[model samples]
Every structure is written in C-alpha cells, then in structure tokens.
Target: MPTLEDRLRNCTRSAVHLEMRDEYMPSDPRFTAWRNGARNDPADSDPERRPWLRLVADLVAQGVEVRRARIVSEPVSDYIRFEHHLTVPTVRAGEQVRWLPRRRASGLALPGNDFWLFDGTSVVFHHFAGDGELAPDDEEFTDDPVVVKLCSDAFESVWRQAVPHADYTLA
Candidate 1:
C-alpha cells in the first residue's frame, strides 16, 4: 500500500483541478443552489479542502510547482497561505507555485458566477469538470486574447467596485 505521502504526491503531480467559483454546488439539482453559502464559503477556504492544501504542501517538498488562484472576499487571510503553498516548495526542491488571491469584497456582488479570474497569465474558472459540469455563465474565452482581456477587465472593474472588507468590520 502506498503511504499517505506517496498518494498525495501522485495526486499533486497529476491532477486536473476543476476551478469552481465560490458558488459551485456539487450536490444541488437546482440551477440556483451552489456548493455552499456564506457560512460554507470555501471560496477562501474550508476544512474539507484542507487536504488538497496539504497535498500541495507535500508536492512543494518534492520540487513540484502548484498554481492556485482564488476569488476571496478577504485577500488578507488567504495571502498567509501563499508562502506555505508556493514558496516553501521552491526552496525545498526548486519547486515554485503561484497562489493568487483575487479579493472579492463581498455583498457587492452576488455569490454566484458573477465573475472569473484572469491575472494576466491564467484564466481560472469555477469547477473544471465534475458533478456540476457546465460552462461559465460568461463564455467568452475561446483562444482569443480579447476573451481573456475581457475577463481581466471584468476583474479590475469588480475590484474597483468592491469595497474593502475592513470597511464594514465591527470594532
């Protein structure tokens, strides 16, 4: 039997991750219901997904590169993981990963497929292919720079529209 570490290595090295927006629901038949809501907002994180993070951590230990991008409501907390997820591996075995956190200042935009992420290099969507297999509401990217640029422009537009999470925090 392969040890947990070995299994993780295999997964990390050969995993076609399905990027899901924060509103992706794996068990809902309705078109409106997503994976989970505010309390279950894994857009930034969750307990169930921690294993994947651990896997990435392991891969980093073995000189594997991981690129992760998330549309987080509060980018501050998620930024904490960028180092552990990307940098450590680079040092361990010359592995490098990019953890890009696109802060989504909540309440401004609905928690659905309102937006996608295009950080100049990648066009990450929500949910690659699985239980809820479907194209993004905004199907523009089709081997055209215009499509990706549109996504990036949309990101910046949303970014400018969104308010700082700390703006509404209780002191």
Candidate 2:
C-alpha cells in the first residue's frame, strides 16, 4: 500500500479529513510547549517547522481541494485550544478548516475513528490509544465503497454546519 503522503500526492480532486477527538498526542512536543506557555506565531511560515503546511500547500497548488473539519466539545479542551492556535498556517496553506461543536453533531451518523478521505475514494483511519497517543500501526486504509460514502457524507454534513475557523471563538 502507498504511504499517506504518497496517496495525498496522487489525489486528483479532493482530500478531506474529519477529526472527532478533542485531544490527541498529549505528549506532542508542540502541544507540550504550548502548555508551558510557549506561544507560536500564527503567521510563521517556516515549512521546516511545520511540515504539514508544505504537504497541504503542494496539494492545493495542484488544484486538489484540501479541507478539514473538526468536531469539538464546547468549553473546549486545552488541546483543542492549542490546535486552534496552530491552525492559521494550515489555513494559509490553502486548506479550508472548520469547527463544529459536538452538540451540533448529535444527529449525524459518524465513523468511530478520525479519517482522511482522498479523492472521494480511499480512506485512512487514524487509531489512537485512550491516553490520546497514536497506537502502533495506527493507520488503517480502505477503499470500500460503503466506507468511502459514509465518510464522504459525514464530512459534508459537518462541513455544511461547521463554522469557518476564522469565525470561531474559543469558548
């Protein structure tokens, strides 16, 4: 199977990601630094510092629409707040990001895990441990039509209702 970056690089139309967890990678250096009061400049554009920016920018430059929708709880978790703070560069890289309050997602049928759907065809699910750490062999990929459709529909539903990241204020 191709690597996630390889799949993303090959995307011809779109790449969408749905993040349902409020906390992830509790021990991530960036998040740890944020917790210690080290703040990142949202306008910082050093690709080496944030590799995701490079990847997303490359995809967008190729006309592949990249988007991310996060479903978060109200009175957000510290991690979510940190994620919000770090999102500017991502948006600037051409990925449309939105936030949907968990309360507002009550009626939607969503998958059990976070996933990246590429070109409306393949899905990469991210599995994590209870402590918010990514489990070993964390990624699971599938091209099943039913799963692809489920993810596609769920993402669109959240995207339609989620507030653009620019307009969302931390609660």
TM-score of each: 0.31, 0.96
**Number of the top lDDT candidate:** 2
Off by over 4 Å in 2: 41-44
Off by over 4 Å in 1: 1-23, 26-118, 127-143, 168-171
Q: Provide the lowest-lDDT 10-residue window in model 2.
A: 40-49
In angstroms, how far off is 57's CA in candidate 1? 8.8
Give model 2's TM-score versus the native structure. Answer: 0.96
Error of 2 at 38 (Å): 0.5
| Index of the highest-TM-score prediction | 2
lDDT of each: 0.37, 0.93
